[model samples]
Target: MASQTDDTDRITVRLAGREHRDWTTYRIDSHLITPADAWQVTLGIPADALPDTVKPWAAVDVCLGQDVVLTGRIDRIEREVAKGTNALAISGRDGAAVMVDCSAPIFTRRKATLTEVVDLAVRPLGVSQVRVEATGAKEKVEIEPGMTAWDALAQACEANGCWAWFEPDGTLVVGGPDYTAAPVATLVMRQSGQGNNVLSLAVTEDVSGRYSEVTVLGQAHGTETTDGQHNIKHQETDADVPGYRPLILVAGDCDGAAEAKRRAQKTLMDSRLEGFTITARVRGHRVSESGKPWTPGQRIQVVSEPHGLDATYFLMARTFLGGRDKGSITELTLKEDGVWLPELAKISGGKGKGKAASAGKVVELS
Candidate 1:
């Protein structure tokens, strides 16, 4: 029940983080200011009048002698409350209101802990791990196990006596820290091979858009030789032409080729493509009396080209038993051309006796 006045008087209030600070006579009166109005006045004080540790949006404890009175965050200056009067609102911890007269009381501001600030700002968005860091403030925080980085940060902020605000767009507004301190995105990739020499790759995205995090999950291409005598070469092509898109690749053997193909196709369809492609390759050998048949290792490659295009190609070798000598290579390429026919024809023409490759439209994979 503090009032407004023109004469300087000492007043105190409890801040959000349970820290207490003293204010000297700058102005005091019998008029009650809304929470919003109190915030405005607090911001109007001269920078030199407040402590050096005081910062914008800080949760300060106000007091009248030894007794704490109110708690709220410091907002900007309130310009036009009334004639010859300067006022600002303080948003209380429990959503209450406490107004202050800027011209009378000499107020003191103090710093709050980092934990306090994060607790007020962070909210769960279905993410698994969350990490929060302060850009400038110093504090040690212990994050609980199995908690997302966001939640851990909130707990830390609360413990440190800081104020955190959640923006309508989902970004966090923290006291004494910048937005860059928040974690952006996390990416997870899992790969497994089946009996049919087919490999499966799974990528998961777990983060909100407010963090401005971009993730690209794709396969890495490399050649490995076993026993030094077997030479395996595999090719991967995309049916669609060039464009910018994120791609993921999987290669290995599977029990059911159809099921593996279905899963891969579904992943491609479900993924958001800015222009990307995925390719897989499979190789196996057939032994004969003339010589040991060559079995090439499976390969999957995802390539992101310069012009914002993504392409993927898969190659599978067909083996012939009993010296029938029918070994052929099949190539499937996904390209991003306006017309698919030209690229398909080019891939088909590249076939040879040592290798037989085929190219088809993206629709074929669908």
Candidate 2:
């Protein structure tokens, strides 16, 4: 058993039927707003700490006291030989990572509901259970030729405004954010170095993800006659954004009018709120208002005086780092509304980019 305290949570590592307790360092990275609820863990120890009979692909389990927090197979092992003693490092992600490497069957012209398509794609992978929330319940989906399982799942998630991720126990869950739910708790962060719950704080905004207008174009089947004139037809939709910079988006090759319109509306609606992130670190393992240890994907209210920001935000991602030297700290990456949508830029490149040069241009993924 591992030790547990009010301000600290102990983690136990088990690999290939052996328990590892002398780890020199460890870190857990969990993405709460991603399609896979992806989590990556790394553990390091002296080389001699390894059991005599150890090999790659061994079953690895991470636990907090008696509760299993993560279960997956180890995919990487590294060794370092220094002047004195060597060190070993191991890392891997959860089961959902496997789906990224696997492929799904291609359906040339099959029509099925969104739920049915998701079931057919993931069922073969031994995904214990699949639950798609309200938004995608009655939607019809088509599986095109040569679509990977991951693509199929992403398609459904994108259209329905939902995210897909596996539970720690390997259950596949697909759902939208519960905006109506109550927040976990109010975390008061003061700028003063003393008597502040937050050790550090950062706020950022990106204009690339914001758009002032969205234009969608879809393919129209067959020709139509208007006033005795034969004409090729097409579907189009447009959305005007308010307050955001005048960036225009042009999306083409949509399946149909409805699909084109939905895509345009969703892309604009989800992007209305600019990308604003608040990153902070808090000491100890904070228990949320929900009575559980703080984790990502939960809503929380934050009061930061120096920043003049007081609002409810979604805990999008978190990293837990703890050791004998630094005790424990929970690092949080938050989104204003906790919406699981894509961002314009993965990172803020340097500060030298000319603002005038980037104005009124659609930001495309490279």
> What TM-score goes with each of the models?
0.17, 0.76
Best by TM-score: 2
Cα displacement (angstroms), candidate 1, residue 139, comes to 43
Model 2, 1-366: lDDT tens digits are 123333226666666566654345667667754534333334455555567545665666765555556666666777877787476767766666666667766556576666876768778766667776545356555667677777777776666555677656656777755544566777777656555667788877665676655655545444355222122223222233336354334443344556655566566646643455778887765554444666666766667777676666667777767754556687888775523443221222211122112211223321
Q: How do the residues 270-295 of candidate 1 rate in per-residue lDDT, one tens digit apiece?
A: 23122333332222121222222221
Output the TM-score of candidate 2.
Answer: 0.76
Q: Which RMSD does model 2 reach against the true structure?
A: 7.9
Would you list the clashing residue pairs of candidate 2? 35-164
